[model samples]
Target chain A: TQLLEQSPQFLSIQEGENLTVYCNSSSVFSSLQWYRQEPGEGPVLLVTVVTGGEVKKLKRLTFQFGDARKDSSLHITAAQPGDTGLYLCAGAGGSEKLVFGKGMKLTVNP
Target chain B: EPEVTQTPSHQVTQMGQEVILRCVPISNHLYFYWYRQILGQKVEFLVSFYNNEISEKSEIFDDQFSVERPDGSNFTLKIRSTKLEDSAMYFCASSVRGGRGTGELFFGEGSRLTVL
Candidate 1:
């Protein structure tokens, strides 16, 4: 079984602060995706990283895939209240199943 | 943007009762999947359906759980006998391709199931 572990399970920061979350795994993945889920709602896709050492940016959020394809990281710059949510990283291999990390709950206070 | 939709946002059933959850995936997508997340737990894959048949399934999908694409637009999951442990939020997802390694999934708002 494949497992993805995320660090900093809970983070509380004031607006304008920056934070980074990490996701690590023992197995290699062909692709990794980041999702943000609000309370009482399903997760919303943030970005998908395919190539090793790839980086993608969406507004204030930046996602990076590790060179070995076994890990990834998400960084938020100048966070705002709207950035508060549960961030999850899912790794996919050849099979259709996606292995997801436990997720990081982030709260940005204004 | 297209999105997956599920009906009866919430359902409550008694143990041993049968329940069916309905989902309408994005119109042009070809692959569909069912996932569940217990309260305070990580999301788990239940099953994946493609070309009108189950392509893959997890150990959690036991004899009581089944999936069907009855028509072009609707996908359904039927639980023959609900158990108290079955209580969770069920999400329906769809992708344009069958390979999760290359495709991104679009998910529904989810159906909350509570088995008493």
Candidate 2:
């Protein structure tokens, strides 16, 4: 099975709508990271959560690490068309290498 | 802000040809990694390097694939024999330290390899 799994392979919502995406894993991780990617570009680091239940806010987005360090969620408050992209969640497992999930493609309409 | 840079931006080659994708990671970063994404596939980790040696590698990084830090600055991934399956976008990333604790990987715009 894929070490990391992201929910809602694709999401589309109107501007100013709130939405949430998820990343899940059966195994524990030292940390989990969230990234955004555009076509032909690499994933850009958005946020990283190390502590269980940790929450961080970036502008209009909120990220939360799971209580068991096995999952994470990203919530956008009033998402904009500019927020549209591929959202990926990566888990840092043993050996300090990261395992990535099939990202969710998010589109925010006008 | 400083960023990772890779080149050539895109490369097209025939099967069995050798191809080297080079990356200059964030200068201050100590850990480097290579990841790839086939069209429509998830980003997959290929390998990680630290202290001039491979720290870890995924199953996809096999005998035909290798990485090197030939100079203090340039880190590269070379495919000894490029197969059609190797066609994908390869990304190079680096972090301040091992795993960066929180895995803050700074990635470069990927190098697209098209094997014909």
Candidate 3:
């Protein structure tokens, strides 16, 4: 079983719609990072949330770290076609390694 | 912006053959790492290197797998003998500092290995 569990493994929405993706884990992490990956490429860093209950925003995207530091969520507003990709959530544990969730594939239709 | 670069974007080899995947991490970065993603799976951490030595490694990184910083600019992963299961996309990432804090990793496009 994956240390991190992501809900709604797949999501499809129309352009301009809003959606939220969740990442949950039983283990506490020092920090959590969200990345978006396109086909035939590597994952790109979206944001890193370190403080519990902290919220950060990037343009139309919003990210929040859980109060317990064991979960996170990513919300995209007015989603566009350019927003379509595989969203991955990874947590950095006590070690240097980053444990990644299975990932949520989001497809925004035009 | 400086980014990690990997070589031999795609490779095809037979089982039992050896393969070497190369990566040039972002300049000025202090940490280097290797991760692999099998099709339709999550990215799995293979190993992390710091100060010229392996700082951490996952169970998937076995005896057959080895990493070397042959020179100052390049980090390479060598698979002594490959198996069909070794086919996957391997990514090389680097960070400015070490630890689980604010250091965000920069990754390359990844090298796809196909073991037949």
Candidate 4:
């Protein structure tokens, strides 16, 4: 089974802090997606990186897909309270199913 | 802002009782999926449906689980007998034709199922 492992399961930081969450896997994936979820809600799509070494930015958030297609990362710059949420990474291979990470719970205090 | 919609935001059922979770995928999307997330756990893929049939399913989708697209817009997941372990947040997702490698899935708000 393909597994996505995320580091720093929980993070708490003050406003304006910059942080990065990592998603790593042993198996290669065709594409990777990043999502942010709030309490009692489903995950909201943030970005999708298909090419290896590709980078995409959404406002203050930057997403990177590893060259090997086995890992990804999400970086937030000058985080605000609104950026606080659970960050998840999902990967899809030849199979139709997508494998999700355990998620990184982020808390930004203003 | 087209998005997937799920019905009965919260459902409470007893063990051995059957429950049906409903979802309305975005119009024009071709692929539909069901995923579940246990408390403090990662989201687990249950099944994937395409062209009115199941294209793929995970081990979590056993005999107790079934999926159906009864109408053009409505997709449902039925659990023959819910167990306490079935309590989780169930999310419905859909994607357009060129979806797989592109990684664009629109998800519903999710249905919280509680089994007692």
Model 2's DockQ score: 0.73
- Name the 10 consecutive residues with the lowest summed lDDT in model 4 chain A: A90-99
**For candidate 2, lDDT tens digit of each residue in A44-95?**
9999899999999999999999999999999999999999999999988756
Best-matching candidate per TM-score: 1
Best by DockQ: 3
Worst 10 residues of 3 chain B by lDDT: B97-106
lDDT (10s digit) by residue, model 1, range B4-111:
999769999999999999999999999999999999999999999998899999999999999999889999999999999999999999999755647588889999
Per-residue error (Å), model 4, residue B23? 0.3
Clashes of 1: 0
Tell me the lDDT of model 2 at A64.
Answer: 98
Against the reference, the lDDT scores of all candidates come to 0.93, 0.93, 0.93, 0.93
Clashing pairs in 3: none
- Between 1 and 3, whose DockQ is larger? 3
| CA shift of A51, model 2, Å | 0.6
lDDT (Cα, 0-100) at A3 in candidate 3: 95
Error of 2 at B36 (Å): 0.6
Candidate 4 has what TM-score?
Answer: 0.98
